[model samples]
Target chain A: MIIECRNLKKTYVADGQAVTAVDDVNLSIAAGDFAIILGHSGSGKTTLLSMIGGLTTPDSGEVLVNGIENWHQSDARLTEMRNQTIGFIFQFASLIPTLTALENILLPLSFGNRKAASSRQARDILAQVGLKDRENAFPAQLSGGQQRRIAIARAFINQPAIILADEPTGDLDEDTEQEILAVFHEYHRQGTTFVVVTHNVHLADSQESPRILHMRKGVLSEENPARTRAA
Target chain B: MQILARQINVLDYALSSLWRRRMKNLSVLLVFTAVIFLVASFQMTTGALTRTAERVLENAPQITLQRMSAGRQVDIPPEYAARLSSIYGISRIVPRVWGYYFDEVTGANLTVMGLATDRMPMGDQLHLALASGSFPGPGSRGSVVLGRAVNDMVQARGSHLLSLFRNDLSMASFEISGVFADATDILTRDLVVMNIDDARDLFRIRGDRATDLCVYVTNPNEINTIARKIADLLPDTRVVTRPQILKTYRVVFGWRSGFGSICLLTALTAFIILAWDKASGLSQEEKREIAILKVLGWQTADILAVRFWESLLVSGISFLVGVTLAFIHVAFFDAALFRPIMVGWSVIFPPFHLVPEMTAQVVLLIFCLSVLPYLAATVIPAWHTASVPADSALSGA
Candidate 1:
């Protein structure tokens, strides 16, 4: 299994009240599987994704990515795993405002060992995102859709085995959302395992044989178990 | 090599981040530079003054003897030199006559020294560099060697002669023989050297009495012993040694500079407070930026490295600029802002250029006092922000 979770739980204290974000959630994803988690706002989809990415520690249970327990590793090793083994696309256009589109795409490589050919690879990725001519533009200079594309390109620069996106097209127009979904399909065809969390249920229709799961009030239930890839 | 390259990349991003907030950072930089300038200027000026004092006093008399009667200094009889000549270690005894002349026209105090022309040349002994013309020759009674400042004052009045009122209110005029060089102006600015008889006549001194006795010793190591002997032999006399004079100058300059530093402490405290506030109170945008970087797989150490680079760039640039400006202020413009405070009040203040003396220890001290505090201020907040879980910070929890 590329990603696995057993009875994972997370609770947050807000205004002196304990709110359970994710409770007793169990999940497994195989290599090259396309899994779409459907949930409304405050449904704990992001919290579960964060645990699988080694971004948050679960209050109980454990998360295993690539057979290594996420919370069991040292901080350095976990950070390295996040950098090399998992890619994340946040809800907003999270490109660094001071960096140009190309530089933002190359941001992940800066944290790890960057090869001499990585610059060329970044330019190639920019061209693949149909933003080759906009590489020199800063985030502020780009439209929301262009900025999202740059962020998506940044996530793919390190070529991680797992791509976890949270509402990657949350605020985009219908056409822009379809454009981003098409880019995702292209990467999925190249055999990258994807676990995308979103409120847009229409995204499930774009994937063939996608394993769809529904999360409501911190509880997760499988909607398309027959489509799930056998692990 | 890969780690170094990664650090360089982070530093590049840090620079870009600072530039994005140029206006805010510029204000902090200006205040920081000003604080450094004030402290560095005081240090450099005081250091130069102390060194100049030591250099000028190197050729001073080994021991000076003055008579004290009724708790006031009185003229010692010239025959006292004869009494001191019998001491075993005493090499030569020279009775000197010098007094302060208050010029009513300029409201300045001038030092008038009487040179013994018949003995060894005082110019060579004191290293007096003549800027023009010559010193008063032996047996020359109506000629005087003027210091640079005194010469300027005399020449400003459109005269080639300096006229002074005698003790009896009678005016005496003397030809200006020469002007002292600018290099020696710090010591000679208010000095006027003339023949011994002319000084005695001007001051109305008795022929048998001299102002003081300058005693030289054959062995420098025996100076304190000789001074003690003279003090014991002449119980009414005050004995001062060269080392004692040097110590007094060091103490005076140190105290003055310390006072100047104290006066500037308020500004430094304000700056430190500003720095602390800026560092500890991370803006929401900055917090978000750190979160985004962490979510992009940057480690806490990487974030700290970026913050370290930012602080270092600000402080390093400020230090270089402040020290350079201070060097120019002391070496070229004569520390105009701090000279009056360090040198004290004087109507005829001598304008002397200070040699810029920056030692390794002084640079290190300034770095610790100014730069390290700012770096520490930045790192603590940076560590706090970086140590938070990326998801929690991104969620603004």
Candidate 2:
């Protein structure tokens, strides 16, 4: 398994009231399997993905990446895992504004011990995103679609076994949204495991062989493709 | 090595980030520089004052015998010089006649010192360039040598001769034979040098009495012993030693400089508050930047290291520029803004040049007070911000 979560639970308290974000979540994502967690806003999709990505620890139970318990590791080791074992694509294409597109793509390499190989990979990713001409341009100078393309390039620059994306297409227009989905489809064909969280049904429905999951009120359940397609 | 390179890259990014907000950071830099400049200028002035006092007192007489009656300085009989010469370890005793002459026209108190022509220190030690004629001859009574300041004041008043009213309600006059050079302005400004006999005659000291006796010892190491012996010999006399004078100078300068430091620290307190506010209150955009770094798998310590470099860059640049400007201001401009308060309220402001006494201790102190506090102030807020999960920061929570 590329990703595993056992009895995972996360809770937050706001204004003296305990709110469950994710509860008793058990999940497994096999290597090279592209999976999507479909949910409405505040349906614990992002929280579940965050825990699986090792960005946050669950209040109970454990998460193992590549059969190695991640939550029990030191923070440095966790960071190293995030650098080498997983990639993240945030909702807003969070490229550092001061850095060029190429530099933004190369940022994750800074957390790891690789510099030269990562620099070459960052350049190759920029070219792959068709933003080779805009490598030196800052994010503010790029269009929304172009910025998102660079963000996608940054996400997979490390060639991680699994990529976790949270609402990746939520901020895009219809045309740009389709373009980003095409990129995801292209990456999925390359046998990279994807655990994507999104509210858009088209993302899960469009996949020919999708392992879809539905989340509602912090509860996760396997979705029947026939029902999703009929809906 | 890879970690170091990565950190260097991050520092480069930090520089770019700071440059984007240069306008805001410039204000902090200017204010920080100003605080450092004020503190440095004050320190440099006090250091210079202390050094000048030491140099002037280096070759001065080891012991000065003054007649004191009920805690007031009185004129000693000239016979004390002869009596002091016979004391052990006394090489030479010179009876010096010096008194303060208040120049009413300029409102400056000019020191009138009488010296034996044969006994003045030669060459540069004389501190006089002989702007005009010559020192008054030994036998030349009622003849005086005026300092440049005193000469200018008397000449401005259309009088070439020094006019004085004697203690006996009689008038005396002295011819200005020459004026001492400008090089000695630090010590001799507002001074009138004359023959000992002329000084005695002008001041109306009856029957060969001099103002004080300056005793030079054969061995400098025996000054304290000789001072005690002199005190025993002249029970009603007061003896002043060079070390005592140096200590008094140190205390005076230290107290004055310490007070200036307190005042400067008041300004620094305001700066510290401003810095703390800026550091503690990270903007939404700034928080997001940290979040972005965290999402890229930067550890909390890495985030803090970036913040440390940012503060170090700001405070370090400010310190260098501030200290350099202060040196120029104090050494070259004669510490114009602070001289009046620091040098005292005298009309004759001495020409002072401060040596750059930036010892390792002082540099460390500047760092501790300015840079360290700045780093400390930012670290806490940065840690708090970094402690938040990257998922939340990226979500803009």
Candidate 3:
């Protein structure tokens, strides 16, 4: 299993009330599997994806990436794991406004050891995302779809083993959504493991042979037993 | 090599980040620069004045003896030199005549000193350099050597001879024999030197009396002992050593500079408070930016590094600009803004160039005082922002 969560649970306190964001979730995904977590708003799908990406700590569970428990690693080691093994695409276009599109794409490479030949790879990815001409434009100058495409290009610049995306197509129009899904299909065909969390149920139908899981309140359940591949 | 590249990349990002908010950072830079300028100016002026005093006093007498009467300084009898001859390790003893002359014409006080005829070529003894003409000789009784400042005052009045009222209220005229060099202007600005006999006659002192007696010691280590002996022998006399005079000058200059720094403390405190407020209170946009960086796989250390670079660039540039301006202020403009306070008020102030003194220790002191505090003030806030979990911050939880 490339990723596994054992009895994951998370509770947040809001105005002196305990809200369990993710409760007792168990899951696993193989190296090249595409898993889509479907849920409505406030259903803990984002929290579960966050735990799997080592971004948020669970109150009572273990997240293992390549069999190494995420919480057991030092902060530096975990950060390195995040940098070299996984890529994250958030719901909003989380681009640094101060940086140009090319610089934004090159940011993840700054934290890793791959410096000598990464600029060419970044340019190649920018061209792949059809944003080769917008490389010098800052996030503020780029349209929302352009910025999202640049962010997706940034994620693929590192060519990580797993891509954790939360509502990757949440706020886009249908045409741009199909374009982004097409880009995802291209990467999926190249064998990149994906864990996408979204409130849109239609996203499950857009992927190829994807294992769809439904989340309600704070629990996760598989929707289609035939599509669930054993890790 | 990769680590260096990564740091360079992050520094580039830091620079761009600062430029992105250039207006906000520029205001902070201006205030920071101003505070540094105040501190560096005070330090440089004080250092230069102290150095000038030390250099001038290097040729001063090892011990000076003056008689006291009713808590006021009275002329010591020339016979006091004979008593000092009995002391061991005494190299030379000279009874000196010098006094202050109030000039009604310019409303300034002038220092008048009588030089012994035998000490003619006092170039070595007093570090005196003549800009023109010669020192007063044995027969030049009614002749005087004027310092640059005094000569300028006299020349401005369209005269070569300086006239002053003697002790009996009679006008005495003396020819201006020479002008002291500009290099010695700080020490000789209001000085007038004449033959000892002429000085005594003008001041109306008895032939047997002198204003003070200067005692030079052959071995410097025995100066204090000799001073103590002189004090004991002449119970009503004050014996001041060269070290004591130097120490007094240092204390005065140090106190004045410290006072200047203290006066500037309010501005410095306000700036620090402003910096602390700006750092501690991160805007929602900034907090979200930190979260985005964290999600992009930057560690807390890397985030801190970016913040560190931002601060270092601001402070380093301010420090350089401030110190450079201070050097120019002290060395070229004569610290005009601080001169009245640092050098004290005078009607006939000497115009001397200060050799700007900048040492590593001084640079380090300014850095520690100005830059370190700013950097420290930002650290906790930066760490607080960096340590937040990306998911929690992004979800606004």
Off by over 4 Å in 3: A117-124, A130-132, A228-231, B67-77, B101-108, B117-125, B128-146, B154-184, B194-209, B219-225, B235-238, B345-353, B393-397
Worst 10 residues of 1 chain A by lDDT: A222-231
Arranged by DockQ with the best first, the candidates are 3, 1, 2
Q: Output the worst ten-in-a-row residue range by lDDT, candidate 3 chain B.
A: B119-128
- DockQ versus reference, model 1: 0.50
List model 1 lDDT by residue over A1-231, tens digit each: 999999999999999999999989999999988999999999999899888988888999899999999888998899889889888888777767777898888878876767754788999888877788998998999998888888888889899899999888877778878877888898898889999999888888887668889899888999859755432
Q: Whose lDDT is higher: candidate 1's or candidate 2's?
A: 1
What order do you get sorting by lDDT, best first?
3, 1, 2
lDDT of 3 at B351: 66
Candidate 2 per-residue lDDT over residues B1-397, each given as its tens digit? 8767878867976787679789988998999999998988888777777776676567567788889999899999867777776688887777778798765656777788887665533313443446678777667778788777777777888987888766775878888888765434455666788888778777777657878888878898998999999999899899999888888878878988899999998898778878888888887777787887787788888888878888888888999998889889877787787877787635335653445456677777776877788778777778887876688644755
**Alpha-carbon deviation at B263 in model 2, angstroms:** 1.5
Pairs with backbone N, CA or C atoms under 3 Å apart (clashes), candidate 3: none
lDDT agreement of model 1 with the native: 0.83
lDDT of 2 by residue, A1-231 (tens): 888889989998879998898989988888877788888998888889888878777899899999988878898888888888788988778887878898888778775655555677787777776777899999999988788888888898888778888888876778767766776787788888888888888887656477889898788898775564345
> Model 2: runs farther than 4 Å from truth?
A14-18, A97-103, A113-147, A205-208, A223-231, B68-78, B85-92, B97-185, B189-210, B217-232, B235-238, B346-356
Cα-based lDDT for every prediction? 0.83, 0.79, 0.83
For the second chain, the TM-scores of the candidates in order are: 0.85, 0.78, 0.85
* Residue runs of model 1 more than 4 Å from their true location after superposition: A14-18, A113-124, A130-133, A136-143, A228-231, B68-75, B86-89, B100-109, B116-125, B128-146, B151-183, B194-209, B218-229, B346-350, B393-397
Residues B1-397, model 1: lDDT tens digits: 8777887888987898789789988988888888898888988888888777777666567898889999988998967888887789898887778899999999988999886655532445443566786767667888898888889899999999999999899998999887876655567788898887788889999876778788888899999999999999999999999999888878888999899888776777677777778877887767777777787788899999988999999988999888888888888888899877777535224565566568887778777878888888887787887866688533544
Give the distance in Å from residue A206's predicted Cα in candidate 2 to where it truly belongs: 4.6
